[model samples]
Target: MRISATVAAVSGALVLSAFAVPAAQAAGSDAGSYRADVAKIREAAHAASGKAALSGSTVASPAADEPYALNVTFSNVKVHSGKPIVVGAAAHVSVPVTYTLTHGADVDITASDFLTGPYIYKGTYAQPTNMLFGEDAGTCTVTSATTASCKATIDIYPGDGDLSNVDAGAWKAGAEAIALNGQDPTSTTFDITKVGLADQGGFASPNVTRLSKLTVNAAPEPVKKGKTITVTGKLTRANWDANNYTGYSTQPVKLQFRKKNATTYTTIKTIKTTSTGALKTTVKATVDGYFRYSFAGTPTTAPINATGDYVDVK
Candidate 1:
């Protein structure tokens, strides 16, 4: 009886050992995966820090009320790790952009940050089938949210590079080697044009070398007490909707007005535009009280779709 009991105990121990073997192996695998994740994150952060280094002339270029595109050129980048980097292996890099506002007080600025295809700033554009995995939004100022010239952080990851440099052995099924997608480095365009602000019209072109650079401004609208009128005044702005009036945080209710037969317009008095569009204001400069105005300009980029309203000039 004693011998039989001892044999049973050994049998139970053997069964438990067999089960433990697989769990131990799985733990080892989990550790390896964790190490790989850490390495990849470190590599991405390093890449972004490098992008922070640029000459003053390189990052920021355009002056205020000027149209410019900051073109960042990347020298061919090679991955030193002979290990394969997956499609999503990303690097974060920030490009420096400089805008010197000639008339900061007078002009409202609209800007957006984007790298590859369509972005959210000026309006969302269609992202292409072969879009790169990078984005620009570090320091962004648009008509919707205007700000002073500041540094914007951007993320740049790969869609391509060269694999021919790696050893063919590293390309083996179970090995790591750098494989590339060979796409262009990427570009972020910043177009500054005068909108609803006071303008003196001497906006110097941004200090960037480009094939074509242009600036189109909005003509000042007329000041009126109350009414919804088609604002026809300056450059040919493509998207001309009341929704384009992007001042999100300002007091929504006010007495608004434009003048009759005026080249430029100003606020007549403080009045709130009811759902019916009505408002009031107390200002000195009063034009012949036509009380409404709109804008005219060519939009290199389109804002959202919206309509203007007519309010009472009470």
Candidate 2:
């Protein structure tokens, strides 16, 4: 279930056709093709039922208008161990996911055409604005006849339209599974009835934030007491659109000082970056200490602190 390509919409429903493996390559242990077929089946079901495109977590049973639902559920889902995903420009960020899959004893989860994994998305589950999935299929270890523990990796490419600045903030987690049952989804007469699908949503919420950077330099390495000392620095954050770090201007930053030989730093004053994200300030030299800058961060950016600059006050 790799998501290296951007998710596109067909008939107003998000589709994975862009990254779907070709039909000729669907015969192997290629879980990507199986997942893509599951998505296609979901789209067909939605069109038949005249409902909006359902999310990957939607569950359905063989009924008058839906594909056969697998008797499976996902639990104990954890992404990055509950930590926020902080991504930088132009780099691929890989996130680890772990979950427990519980299913009926009749379900053959180890089949070549069967695959399941966790995903994260922004917006509603039924209609996600954007979504991300693992680069490879999940690997599972059977803990019991009916349960398995699974681990997968979610690969994010900030430079490849996988994310944008507006995507930063909270994201919801979900899990999905599909069983093709040896059916050829690429056939024009492909039967959807033989496929099994299960989707579960709202298991957890994880934060995604842009990586931030800060740098500081205090002038006058050796200064006389009572003389003014100047501090200068810059603040920048990841720019997903440009695939680089750019100035994060007009944001509040803190000036901190730690006396020489001290292990703690205390805030000296609060200041804001210039239009170009540059920082400059002056403080009277009163003691031998180290100076630095700190950014408390925002909903879209991660917090960071500059390395302290040492100054010997004579």
Candidate 3:
């Protein structure tokens, strides 16, 4: 059972390394959750144009069974990647490279093979492939194109991974010496320190793998009990490829509502997922319970539950 670990696999090539990391450590179990760590290196850090810092946590080799976090700063980074494309109704870019393609970053020496999937976080880790895609950071060496610099075009809002809780027990980052590159290399260091969950709504966490941020926005108003309130929302990050795999986007989302101050919300409506992956539905807001919602659909991606949840109001 070779897990497809590194890079993209040619059309029908056998993918063995894909599940390497998860398989080796847990051998059929998901790895312990990790958080982004950055406090240790924050002491001597200074704001310089060439300075950048990254901090995050990883599963301790079964030897520890605890979350391990580390922080490191990089200088003179050369950013590499194809290009960033906006996903759905968000102001972020989604890296559209598959596992077979090679994307290079100056901070990391080994040109990263396209990512495989997020297997360890959900259930038991698979063995075979022995690879962990879309997580961890790397450092690289540059040949000094004279203007050699370190660049990280974070298309997946706050880098790919999961929806990290801001100010919670989730991952956090801080960057100084900020520079912005238009449709290209950004020349500044930005920090995601002390950010609140509300601010990171449209961003993903450094802990999880996949950067799918879907926000269901609704007006903040009190609803009357036993009334039919008009419910409307806009899905944030929706991406669908109907041609690649069989039924990649199938199960639809059921939109329901609860009372503003009641309990036990029930399904009052349903909305089907579109080819674009974003769905805007108008449902009936039943009862006066807390406005809660969720998606009854599931995805073919990795990291346990590919099925989306209620991103917002009831």
Tell me, by TM-score, which candidate is best.
Answer: 2
Worst 10 residues of 3 by lDDT: 194-203
| Candidate 1 vs candidate 3, lDDT winner | 3
lDDT of 1 by residue, 267-310 (tens): 43332223422222333333344333222211121211122222
Per-residue lDDT value at 308 in model 1:
26
TM-score of 2: 0.82
Off by over 4 Å in 2: 1-46, 52-66, 186-190
Roughly what TM-score does model 1 have, to 2 decimal places?
0.18
Error of 1 at 24 (Å): 39
Ranking by lDDT: 2, 3, 1
lDDT of 3 by residue, 56-112 (tens): 222232121111111112232211222222222222333321111122232222323
What's the lDDT for all of these models? 0.21, 0.77, 0.26
Better of 2 and 3 by lDDT: 2
TM-score of each: 0.18, 0.82, 0.28
Q: Which candidate is the best by lDDT?
A: 2
